[model samples]
Every structure is written in C-alpha cells, then in structure tokens.
Target: MTPRIHGGTDALGPARWDFSSNANACGPCPLALQAVQQADATRYPDPSYTRLRAALADLHGVEAARVLPAASASEAIQRLTAWRARAGDRRVWTPPHAYGDYAHAASAWGLERVAGPALAQLVWLCDPGSPLGQGESGAAVQAALEGDARTGVLDCAYAPLRLRGASALDPAQRDCVWQLWSPNKALGLTGVRAAYAIAPRGSEAAVAALQALAPSWPIGAHGQALLLAWAQPAVQDWVAASRTTLAAWAQDLRALLARHGWACAPSDTAFGCARPPRPLDATALRARGVKLRDATSFGLQGWWRLSAQQPPALAALDEALQEQEREAVR
Candidate 1:
C-alpha cells in the first residue's frame, strides 16, 4: 500500500519509475507485441472480448460465459464489486493497507467503508497483500465469506509470484465474487489494458444481470488479443522469468533496509512492508533523489511499500536509506 500522491508532476518520466506492481518494469509482454502488429486496424474487434474470454476461460477451467474482461483489474473489480453492492449489500470491508483502487471502487457505490474483520456485507482482500506480498489461505478466506452476504474479492494481483491464487470462491456461496489476476503484474502487459473475472458458471442470469447494468462493451480488439496471448502456456513461461528476478530483488531490498536499521515486515514476495512512519523517510530520501512510496497514505499503521521493479534499484535503495539516516541528525 503506497501513498497516493495527487500530482506526481516532479516524479514524472526521464527517471526510470520503480514503484509499480507490474511484471516487467520495462514494458509490455513480447506476446503482446505480436498481438499489436497482428491486429486488423480495418475492422472493429469482437465487442464481447469473445476470443479473449474463451482463452481466459480455458486457463481457469471454466466456461467463457462466466468470465468478463475489462480495461484493468481496477475496472473489473469495480464493476463486479459495485454490482454486488448495488444488489442490497451495503458495506465493503477490506484490509487496512490496500491498493487504493478497491477502496475507491467501494466508495463509488456509496458503501460504508470499514476495513478488516469488522463484519461487513462484502470483504475485499488481496490474498498476497500488496504491501507485504504475503498470501492467505483459501480456507480462511472462505470462512470469512461465510459471515455475511458478502462476496469476498480476492485480488490475485500478484498471485504469480506467490504461486497461489483465487480458488476460494466455489459454485455455492451466493455471496462470493473473485477479482482475478491483474495482468499488469502477472503478464507484463500494463498498457495492454486487460483483466478478467471468474464468476461461477451457471450464473448466466447473474452475469447477464451484471452485463445489462454496464453502459458499453469493455476491451477493444487490440486489448483482447493481448490478453489472449498472455494467457498462453508459452508466454506464461516468460512471466516465470520475471517472477524469479523479482524474488531476488525482494531479498536485496530487505537486506538493504536492514542496514539502515529499518524493520521491514518479513515478506514472501517482492514488496516489503515496514513501519516507523516512512512518509518523512520517503520525503527525505527523495531530497537526495531516491523515490519510493510512503505508506502513511494507506491508513495502515506507519508502513511503507517498496517495489522491486528494477535491478538498479538495489544500489538506489542503499544510497537512499543511508542518506535518510544521515539527514535524521540534521
């Protein structure tokens, strides 16, 4: 969970950006490159995300009708969660430190925002948390869903790194909704603008009921093809490489922070969490030119979420942390 700064004007391009949850800090998937070249500019794409939906359906072992593709996981989760909220479910509870988008979506529906175990109609959680990059069990997730008409949204935004994902929702729970993987993180297609949802099959009416509520078809032709390629077995192998690189970087970040006496939360994946109110830490670090997210804005208890998006960031972290400590004396 990173603080959402209003205008990242000063932090714009020119410098390589590292604070991201996407797979390749570099760019879109190679598979996506092929899709972009192959797109037929002469005609409109399948308005339904049909080919792409079928591909994603096969990946999840579900029928195509049960899936819905969107602009991003942010939009996909918003639509699904908002639909449930509209259907008489009032509250949407999420963890304290969240991706910022979930809370934004919940707020859109006029749902009362309460986070973490307070008993709400809907609970949105990133199983492998965004800040800590740690995942929770499907069984524990299911038990939480049992308490309310709440449809638990397991945001599998970083499932690839943890090797775990959204299998918590079954065919039964009338209140379960799953926010599947955000391709930006798992497949390196951040600009491809693709994400899909896995709803229980046979919920055609429920699905259609949702469809009718939407104003228009999501995902253009080019975006659809990009998602389909990313879902391929061959391309997922390349995604595996990115995960390996991220894991190594995560370890390095933890070590670098420890040298500065920063107690980062033990993480299972790339993003490491830590406290002692890092807002000032980030401000101080930036003064000497090392940019990172300050966790203060997340409303969590004084923690920061650092991204392991680049190898060069390893050296950057060391210099920044050291500078932060020195500035403290002044």
Candidate 2:
C-alpha cells in the first residue's frame, strides 16, 4: 500500500512554529476547548449519535436524517469511496490541487482518476481548496451538478476558516452534493478526530449507504463534546472573530514573505502557496523548529503551502530563511 501524505504535526513530533497544517491559527476556540476538556470519557458515546447528529443538522439547516457522522474527514472520504466502490463505481474525479486523502482513498478503493467531472462515477470538490485556498470555479461546480456521477463530495474543512471571498457553489448547488465539515480545523482542535457530512437534500439512499459502511459509534465522547460545542453560538462567534485576526496575520505574513523575495500565489483564505527566491532545504528548517508544508503532494512542485500564523511564528520562519540563505552563500 502506498503511504498517505498530510500536513500538521507529523512523525517528527510538533514543530515550535508550525506552518504546515492549515488549522486555525487563532485557536483552539476557548468554548470548544472547555467542552473537550469537560468531556466525559467514562462511558461510550451514544451508538446512534442522535443528539449530536441533530445539532449538526440544525447548524446546516438540514434534516436530521441527512447528517452522516465520521471519525474524521479522511474517514468520511474512505467510507464514501468504499460505498461507491461496492456499487461498482470505478472512476473518480478531483480538482487539479486538493487534499491528498481524496485520491488516497479513491486509490485504496480501486477507483481510477479520470479527467473532467462529467466522466467520473465519483467526484470530489473542495471549495477554498487546500494548499492554495482558492475557491473552485462556479462553472465547474455547475458542471458537476449536471454530471452523471453517482456521488459527489464537497470537502468543507476549510470553509469555516475561509478568510475572504465567497463560495463558488450557491445554496441550491451545495445541496446537490455531499458537504463534509470537519470543525476541528476551524476550532483548532485538529487532534480531536470527528467530522460529519450533510447529504444532498433528499439523499436518503446515499446517507443510508454511508451509514451502513461506517462503524458503530463513529464519534467518541470528546469528539461529541467538541462538535456539540461547535454548534453553540458562542463558539461560532469565536470562529468569526478569529478570522479577523487571521486576515491581518495573513496579510502581514504575505508581506514578510514577499520582502524576503518569495513569490506567493493569491488566495482567498488564510493559507496559500509560495515559492522561495531560492530553493529551500526543508529538513534543515525543520531541525531549527520550523516546518512548512511541501506542496509537491498537492502537485505544485517548487512551491510550499504556508498557514497564516502569529508574529512569533512568522519571526521564527523569517530567521530560519535568513540562516538558510547565509548557508547557501557560504
């Protein structure tokens, strides 16, 4: 089996100044944090996750039966892929640059990648896509809606944390596809694994298929608490406020990188891809307590994905780049 590539704190343990993962830089949200800290681990969560699912449904203004909970977005992706594979769907379509787990899960289920949304049996779309934070084209979304694909999933992991711009999909278009939400990234609780999907309006059959493939009690006590907290007004308020901070930080970080001669791609969200004026020795920088995501996995060679972080983290990165430049000159 091929290994999966991802960002965030990796096998090397956490970096002092992590620019790898695109999780909210201003979090973990205090309210959500309290909920996680207060979670009761003494017993298992409800097998059906009735209340939890209902709360998530209410948040998205969907019917309770339309919500499908998973251990994480990756788990949701895998289960959905498995469901499509079992139904004899063999082709998958993905955006040019997207989260790796889409392709990884598709490959695991023997689904081949096909060009164009209209040609595939299963299609994946990420609005404010990963590694770039750019929204998908509205025309392409309309095309996917009109395609013959059996299932289409829109990963909304970054949607909550989107710093700017509007979604390409309108309300009706969004209802035509699976909308996956992993609030952990927005809440800065990525360590807590839990995610849920809102099935397309009237997608009972698809919901049933996904539930059948999922293990019982997909979310644990902590995950339940985190998600429950996520539905609270106070938590939503916090997330909204954090975006203001992230926007400022993102602008500052971009300017800093530009001053250092890095070329950055324009982004609508808090994270983006950039290329250093010169090649960077990533491993050496990691050793210096800073880590950046190599965008190679996202198919952007010679570029790196950077999450907008606070001044301290940005300062560390600036110093590390300077050190690398000195070493290169030597």
> Which is the leading candidate under TM-score?
2
TM for every model, in the order presented, reads 0.83, 0.98
For all candidates in order, the CA lDDT equals 0.65, 0.90
lDDT tens readout by residue for model 1, 83-201: 88779887777776667777777777887776454467777767677666666646547655675355666777677666324434445542255656666666555556667777654
Q: Evaluate model 1: give its TM-score.
A: 0.83
Encode model 2's per-residue lDDT on 1-330: one tens digit a residue. Answer: 346888888888999999998899999899999999999999999998999989988888989999998999999988988988999999988898888888888888888999887788888889988989999876558667875555778989999988778898889889999999999999998999999999999888878888888888999999999999999989999999999999999999999899889999999888999999988899999999999999998889999999999899999999999899899889
Score residue 320 of candidate 2 by CA lDDT: 94
List runs of model 2 lying over 4 Å from the truth. 147-149
Model 2 root-mean-square deviation: 1.1
Q: What is the lDDT of residue 322 in candidate 1?
A: 62
